[model samples]
Target: MSDLVTLGQRIRHFRTAAGLTLDQLGDRVGVAGSQLSLMENGRREPRVTLLTSIATELGVTLAELLDTTPPTPRAALEIELERAQRSPHYTGLGLPVVRAGRSMPDDVLESLVGLHRALLERERQAIATPEEARRANTAQRLHMRTLDNYLPDIEELAQQVVRESGHTSGALTHREVGLMAQKLGFELVYVNDLPHSARSVTDLDNGRIYLPPASIPGGHGLRSMALQAIAHRLLGHEVPTSYAEFLRQRLEINYFAAACLMPREQSVAFLSQAKADRNIAVEDFRDAFGVTHEAAALRFTNLATSHLDLTVHFLRVGNDGAVYKAYENDGLRLPVDVTGSTEGQLVCRKWSSRAAFARTNRTTEYYQYTDTPEGTFWESTQIGTSASDEFSITVGVPFADSKWFRGRDTANRHRSTCPDPSCCKRPDGDLAGRWRGKVWTSAKLHAHILSPLPSGTFPGVDDLELYRFLETHAADTEG
Candidate 1:
């Protein structure tokens, strides 16, 4: 039927838009790749079982398929997902989609499941094309290095924009920065709705970044989202997939923004002066370069860790993706499977409260505490900083790698626990001495530490020195 053919085309279009391929659809629907191709090409009308499989795989509903048109509402995505669960794909694979009659509205849950299924399908398809996987892997590996190579110019331009804008509350809206990029002929397409979270993918050949919204939450996540978006925009394009990787990418963006704000000569001169003083406050830094606190912190930390030879690490409860710790060695080595709070709240405990501790024992360890901001905190004893009521500290050493560490596979050893509720509250406090472990983050890790500037103050310390110190020293001094 022409209608069925048309529907197949629509499904194909949606699949591509969702960043999937035919083989992915097949796996999700539990059909072979060739079978999916036949269905898509309209060689055979999909049976009800196959139709349901296709719907679930695409995260659509049976009604959506029967109607032969894509649904516009978010609710449609849920129905499609439900239909997929009911399809023969699950049965074919001996996997049964749960039938929950008493559960709450299944839309969001179903949609999420559908997304995961689609991703699984895509991964399966990707494995078949070893060459493609290799190419993608190669591309990801080079993306950061190549982007790093071009950062000087990006920093300089960002600086100029800040100076020209003259608005520095340490917060710049995403819309505002996007408009600026647009003025410069860079188009902004937000993928995630978060304001401060944005990314810039580049058409590398044209030297242009296509700014996409970093998350899908929309305006609610606008502020932090915007900073990330602009940071990526500053980089030419092609971002690392995770937060740690993004941090490395942002570091490069910060460098680029700095270079743009202060040309190579001016930046050198500015750094020479600041390096002498070691007192770049967020406001002063913001004034000097047109960027937000978040952006400034990212850049400042990168500069300290990369060029100043200082170690900086940041950890915050919900902002683990924003965490960083600088180190001189390759990275922090800890046991793969060691658990408790060190993996979860190490950042919040250290930076948020500035905790202090003496090594309790030689073995791996962990701890947690709360303070009022005016009392004696953990760091006060060891580092000699004045005590604050708001401070708390927990320390942990790593354990040796083991089978549990390997987590059902020899190659993929576990790094940290899932950050779900009920996870340990203070990971750094429990330092286990044995395992070979590196720090955990959502960003890429760098091996070297920049040398301290001449000033007693760390060369790249920002207005927020207290937090910067914790970020820089946490990993090395933890054990």
Candidate 2:
């Protein structure tokens, strides 16, 4: 019921309970009997002054007569639907505003409610800042780690794709991937002008994949990118319907791509061989598979525990010490923020990931032995460039498994008192006393940090473009 109707009912109940007829109550509140009778019958709405006067004459506070109790679920739903129809975000979708007193079918009402809820959720997600995105990424990484950083379903699909392509039993080359793409009916187009934020774009309608011209000459990066695009098509991943689905599908496609680049059987065999030889080098794995060091590190996590019986940790740390990505199944506890997030946390300078930044030679890999409260670990780090940052990718294993690695005996050792102070690494009373109040870093703001996610049916596409594409495709499908 509307607030006005509820108020009228309350007035009638209270006036009858107080043993007053409509005229008696009207005389006390300076309203005519007929005017008050109309309100009681819900034909007329009462103004606030009359409401207050009636509440006083009825010997109750205005709030008491207003019936401030929480609404029933059905009433709450109706109120939400009303509020949603009036919201700019909802109206901006070109949906009609549902006014009071309109009779809606039950199914239609439920559908609108669901759509309103979804749009509200999308708006909430869209307004997330970079820090929030970082936290979300950290949560997703934790989830991936919880799944042992492996997806057997996606891997199985990838293996099927490889077998069907007749390219079995080894790492795939760029030319081989191209042939596979052709077999799957996709054309690769190298374009000079692609969006800076996008490395590749697939036009499903045209059966074409666009890539930057620089990525055309058959390198590890190009091969990986091409394989990822191909994997998306081959695996039958639909365009994502939501942000969460987008993240999941992206991870699935990435896993499929990695599987394509490093087939499970071959990758397992290589890791087994490396484990037997007691010399696990990421570079050797990268060279064997023609993939980047980062890829090799991530791939190792996929196979380490399940295949090699060794738990490991991997980290991608920027030059300024912010963690870009991190995963650990090992017992070693990584540094985390207040929210238990490892990503975007400042790495302790004593840790290998951060110390690798000090190496003068960016080309050479840096190795370190670190003793933490959790345990001792051996870490190998190499410098790499991402889209807009220079970062160090490090893979570390427990001390028990360190003997199998070549960097096990690195003289670079540090005691890390991370997530804690008063340890040997942090000078007890010396620096604290000397520079107690002397230093403070100024905060810098970047506008892009608060920019909303791209607007469209898909996260990054333009909405109008997506609508047009859908329309054209719909007509084609109908024809």
Most accurate candidate by lDDT: 2
lDDT for each candidate structure: 0.40, 0.76
**Number of clashing pairs, model 1?**
112
The C-alpha TM-scores of every prediction are: 0.30, 0.69
lDDT of 1 by residue, 117-148 (tens): 77545433333232332333334434533332
Candidate 2 lDDT over residue span 1-479, tens digit each: 35655566677778877999999988988889999988864569889899999998989998988884423444445556765676666677786667433276666777778888887777655734456555666678789888788888888887776777777655587677777778778877666655544667777776767676744443777777888888778777765644455667778777888888888888888889988999889988888887888998999899888888888999988877777778998877877867676766667788888888788887867899999989899999999876676888999998888988877778999998776765434666777899888899986433332355675555665656544544654464468
| Model 2, residue 152: C-alpha shift (Å) | 1.2
How many clashes (backbone N, Cα, C below 3 Å) per candidate? 112, 0
lDDT of 1 at 265: 41
